[model samples]
Target chain A: MDFKKKQTEANLKPGDRTVPERKIPVPHRDISERAQEMIAAPYNVFIDWNLNPPTKDDWSKIVTKVSESSAPAVNKLIEDLGLTVEQLQIGGVKCYRLTPENIPENHRKQLVIVAHGGAYVYAPGIGSVREAAMFAAFGGYTTISVDYSLSYENPFPGAIEDMIDVWRAILTEYDPRSVAMTGTSAGGGLIMATILKIKELGLGMPAAIAPSSPWADLTETGDSYKTNEWLDNILVSYSGYLGLAAKLYANGNDLSHPLLSPINGNLEGFPPTILTSGTRDLFLSNTVRSHRKLRRARVPAQLHIYEGISHSQLSFDPDLPETREAYGEIAAFFDQYLIW
Target chain B: MDFKKKQTEANLKPGDRTVPERKIPVPHRDISERAQEMIAAPYNVFIDWNLNPPTKDDWSKIVTKVSESSAPAVNKLIEDLGLTVEQLQIGGVKCYRLTPENIPENHRKQLVIVAHGGAYVYAPGIGSVREAAMFAAFGGYTTISVDYSLSYENPFPGAIEDMIDVWRAILTEYDPRSVAMTGTSAGGGLIMATILKIKELGLGMPAAIAPSSPWADLTETGDSYKTNEWLDNILVSYSGYLGLAAKLYANGNDLSHPLLSPINGNLEGFPPTILTSGTRDLFLSNTVRSHRKLRRARVPAQLHIYEGISHSQLSFDPDLPETREAYGEIAAFFDQYLIW
Candidate 1:
């Protein structure tokens, strides 16, 4: 922890230097105790992934396991929030429609499209509905959770195409000005990519988008990859499964292609955006860079960074004050921008 | 940097665990070479002070040495930016007035006050003019840099009182609506504190303020204090001179006093504000928390965080793209809020 010592020239490239290993305890700061416990817990998804990538069957099995384990909690969340969920296929893309028991009058006609985060590989089916449940519960709006093609079966243009189809289909029933998008991690990145495509294909733009800890940069780019490498509890480093997942999803496409790394996209004419990330999230830079890109293009943008959080952990518990505040911010933003 | 392994129970507090020492190369992501070179260099101000705080005389000598060392570059910056510096006394507080050539027609009647940062102990005289010069050059407004009493010579209320005096005197000649304020690090904290005092005294508020890498929380009450401890490079940790400086500044007063730690202050009436920091900045959380507090109070606030840079290193070199962009953001914020 002594930062006074200077490293000697060890023949390492500037980008090749490693941050030393040290124990980072949960900071006793202004964050909630629940957040502290999450930080104190072991880093999430710390699997000893081998050199070879997981086969599609392996990924499918993993996804199924994760989905089964998460289903009970998602069901509880749906029931606790007085929401109803129905599986449907819109334009051949699988989706979940979550409707709250009591929608606010102002939000009765508003719609929020949800994209779930799973590294573009894991978390399918019921596992993808947790965020939708929280959005429905907190924002008091009907939500549609998009279940796009995972990289294990399909690759880059596949998820994008599926989301485009969903967006196109959703627009027929709801006013584009009443539609907004929300997602976390890979799902967050997908929403940004979907917006870019929406703008490019001449589809009407949504009112706003909230991308939480968006994995907007597919490559191991950005300072947080190095600074928050091991510090982040989830998605600890790009060298692990995150990098593999990025490669699988890119499917030989340049990772920097605006669609793969939406942070590099032309964000002009994009809708108002509110991004959320934690200080310890590995994609902290992705969220930060995405915010900067939006601001540079004169888009109205707001950013919320939670203390001691890693990845999309804020979405883990809707009862947490941080989660409530985040959803409140997004809802308020929607209220300001979404046409009645 | 494998995070797969959990730490063994080593009888360390969650806050006492040290981040392992590793070489952190300048990220090859989206930062300028100058910033990379800074991150690649030895940590700034890495002193070998013994296990005792410096005496006032020793502190004065240290400040003078730093000021002398920084003088040449500060002078060069003033000349290159075509700014004129004048010494003056307003309300018995020593100050530097920086006037830019070719002030914009809309900004001819506006004024900006600058507070220099040195952990509240250093950066006196010409050393304090760099930020003021940058503001004048980038913002095209006449700026007055307040040279408050150093904490070594005078503590908490000293800097606050001096700033309040400067504010009162400046307001006599300039409309509060046409004036703005900015500072870096300790100076940033001072501006926030002074504004709190200004409001308490029923003085009108400025149009906007930009505080870059503000040390707003004196009690090490944020995640960055621990997560960015050594990685920050500047103000390496609170246990070092930063802690000592905080103690000296607070004297016997409580560290969490709203005037000392403005992040906890009632920020309801704060003017439109913009905050800037970097991912590696030790005060990143301070900036984040301040923005959160301001937003919670319904104040319009924006945050800009550069990649890889630490502390207020953005103000170290005027020619760096990051520095130019930071100043541009501040200038634009001022233009949007300051009355014409």
Candidate 2:
């Protein structure tokens, strides 16, 4: 029996007194019949609001809270996805390894190393660092995210050193050219710095890198710090929030030191890079400038800027079309450069 | 052996001539010292631009293209997540079941049935229908999404009849009160109609219902269809695109027929409802009005509106914090009432 037709027939009877008028005086609405032709219509996609810059103290508090951010619920999320979660001590540094349950034999050697971002603080352990690598694993890689020490105590080069050590240890099992490195925000910058450090120490580089809205310059020096200031919700401005992160991580060192801010370092031989940012990201210039520098240095680089998004917001949601597009691009880039 | 200290000392040599000036003339940037105050600051969170509605034919083309939208990559996404994908025929109707690889014994009877949105036209197959049920599976239920007949061919009573048949078959296997129904856009509206039909037929009501920005009023009769016209990127305006979906599905039926538009249906016993929308959703009024009707009828109902988002954008991104928060809430709601 077609219950739908029966229901509709029951609801409407011509000239029947029982079909009541709308109970409330409904607000006036435009009818679809009046939809005039849109001549090259320009549409609004998302909220485009701005904010007043945060006070230094306010900025510090915000940065501190972010650094201390933890996702207690993420382990369950990883488990629910059925990925194998393992905690490994590499050269005395903590790293969480997420291996997809099954894959083609040829895809086995491919690995994606992630450095979790918390402005070089926060995300202090394996639990907090899971969100960053979840995307890479979901992108179909055996992913391992380094749980580096934060600047709250370790400070400056300490986080970078931890990542370098983890990388050095993992390189023994996986070919350098078969691996990819990725990070976001401070973690993004850390990947750049770690590459430079590895290069300086004469170590091999990964095949590719995907850095999402990297904080390349830590000295509050990019144009985005002004133009897109307060437009980005996460990192409001370099001067307010990021500068605090810069100082906390720098530990009173010169802000432009190559090891602390990779934007100031040489870019001549960097890995094939896929960089990302949003129009409203405070680190927009960091991405644009890095892409230009890599190109000028003859390093192959691709930049993907998402419209109407803030720093790393796309990275947070794996289910978003943009997130899939973003990570899918990264995966394809790796597939091109690596043996996968 | 302090690698961090050694790395920092080597990078910084005070008064060294090798430190280069910035390669690019960066724009004037703001400084942290001048963050005066944000006294009574109003934050802009979304894009609020307006546009003239598209011509009827142009609108229809766009809507048709969107309705025919399919996620070709979804099956891979599911397999990568390690969820078991199974297809079943229930009373000659097609359904795709995505069961978590390792569900606790107690949770097996609990199921979330999904009706995917595409104005009743999109997500055509097992692959296309994955997005609708991903959240339910993430909520730790054995999830199954119906492959209901599309309006493109089946139209009107055809799709709803298929749903009723599938629901009836599934109900025979699992308790109705342990099931929760969900959908978005046309799919969302379908769930409402299905629940009403089930109630009319004296079937036990599901534990809860979560409809994301449902198109409850297909009549172009809601206030948001006018106010949010051109503001919502996907829908833009009801007159432009959605009215096409309405007409195609109505198949000569009156727009206000309760089966065609569930807002006209009874809300007195809608099961516990959690309705979702965004400030930019064209269906904001549908969700709001539905919530209001359920409350007036003394039915337990809750509404969630994401700030600066438009129509199912939260649903589109699984990685989005809003997506997690949304499904997490649904899962929790189901947990409270369902015996499992």
Candidate 3:
């Protein structure tokens, strides 16, 4: 049955017009459309969707199973594709590179890595990778974009292992203090996960990390999930999320585990962090919860929530004023923490 | 005649010398003996020797003449005296009541008002009615303490102003945020002179202010005066400040003129401020210039200097945990701004 029929059967009472039925809004429909575009855009090819084509009866279960399976598949795909190394390496893993030819010499010494978002189901896509490169070139930093394994094929350990390899390779060459990591959406989730992993391995932390509209909690405990269901311009409904990608990524593991859901992670000893999100982003709750957790942990975290921007807005158009401001703030934050 | 020759004659040199040329730090002297007893023991009156009496050279010709005529004969005999006012009226111009019971509820509001140091002859005296009451009880606000006037009547604004009127009244109120204002030496010059007076005429800004090692420029421009003079502890050297205070608070008009000296009249719109000073208490240069100007301008100001603290030690007091962690950080700053 559709969600509406299920709700009606579960909650409806005969002759109870007084009890209003929850109705999905138009904005949610619009967001779903945008999400589809974001997922299907040409730049997304680098990320293996690892989707388990739609099935009948228990739609939710099917999607969850697929998401879990996709994780390892994403890992195998990365290997089978023979993704080329692009010069820059950290901790012995190949990190994609943006050339110094585009960036000024003074700024080239700096590096900014942009991690892609897919709730751990996808790799860094071309658009996000290019955006990272553009930001590095304009802001005077060498940029690396990582394309990690997704959930459907490889599941839990697949993405984590690939990311660690990439980080180790990069750390081998660059001073940890000179590096800055930033990401949006699922990409944001990975950036944080990467930090936690690096810290565990006794590696030096990056100078700073900026996670925009991060999905820190896969458990969906944030108030915004319910309050902003239809109000947000993007990720309006958790149906697609809780039903599909989240389930796939969990791969039968407890979704609340810190490694799987970093919002619950022990954030002590983390470097200064900056979080940015918009009121209209579906993941607003995730961003706020993460920021509050960081603050309570005394992690020197700063959160700047834009009034009305959507998820991934910063990378979508760097020409926009808000995007520039966000980027500038990130740069300034780096200037304070990361001395050349 | 110059400080250099006097220092040489006194046989004072830098670096852990047992006996310094200046009597301020007499070898084997209990530096805090009197202060400790005053702070520890309950006493109605307290006094300390070498409290760095203002020098005659600090007064301008006109101020010197006024001092000669207005000097109280009994002041020379008494080291220090403490009194509570039932109501002290000055020249029938401004009236203030001293009774703890009579102080209005609003006037009783907790607040600490520190007197500016300018070796007296400059800022308003304890007896000056408006300086104490208006700042303390006016506009439904309560303030306590006034540094008693000091100097050539015994030079410039004296220590009496700081000890008696300002500090005494302020002690009645003890709320930390309510308590504000400080001064360096020279009664710490006028901490409120800069922003308060202007604010009183409708330009008051800032709820609190801090002037560190001020230079309430009595001589106008003593940026680096007597740079090569005696080994000065509290100031760059004493010659610069001595010449300046003497030039500014020369006569009756000079002492009262808002521009020349603030000690004599009209201290309105002053906020709570803090000032810092040190054992060296290098006469005028350290406290007079920046602090007096703030008080004259009617800004709320305070000064808190360490006994052995050098000039501007508050800013560099990370070694002293209290000083470092409690320095006026953004949280304290927000306390003032957030209310408005």
Model 3: per-residue Cα lDDT over B58-168, one tens digit each: 344444443344334212211121223333422222223322224334335444344543434443433232223323222223333342444444333333223333333
Q: After superposition, how far is residue B196 of candidate 3 from its true place, in Å?
A: 17
Candidate 2: tens digits of C-alpha lDDT, residues B66-117: 4444344576567655688788888678888887777666667888888888
What's the TM-score of every candidate structure?
A: 0.93, 0.44, 0.44
Q: lDDT tens digits, residues A76-154, model 3?
A: 4333433322645455444566554444544546677878665665433343354465456446666787766557566
Every candidate's DockQ is 0.46, 0.03, 0.01
The list of candidate 1 runs beyond 4 A from truth reads A1-20, A45-53, B1-3, B6-19, B45-53
Candidate with the larger DockQ of 1 and 3: 1
Question: What does each candidate score in C-alpha RMSD?
Answer: 3.0, 21.3, 25.9
Which candidate tops TM-score?
1
Cα distance off (Å), candidate 1, residue B3? 8.0
Model 3 regions lying over 4 Å from their true place: A1-52, A55-94, A100-108, A123-125, A241-243, B1-204, B207-340
Top lDDT model: 1
lDDT of 1 by residue, B1-340 (tens): 3333433222123433345456565776666787787776544443332224458788888778878988998999999999988999998999999999889999999999999998888888888899999889888989999989998888889999999888889888989999999999999999999889999999989999999989899998888887877676656667768888888889989999999998878999999999999888889999988887787799998888877777888877888888888898899889999998
- As a TM-score, model 3 comes out at 0.44
lDDT of 2: 0.65
Top-down lDDT ranking: 1, 2, 3
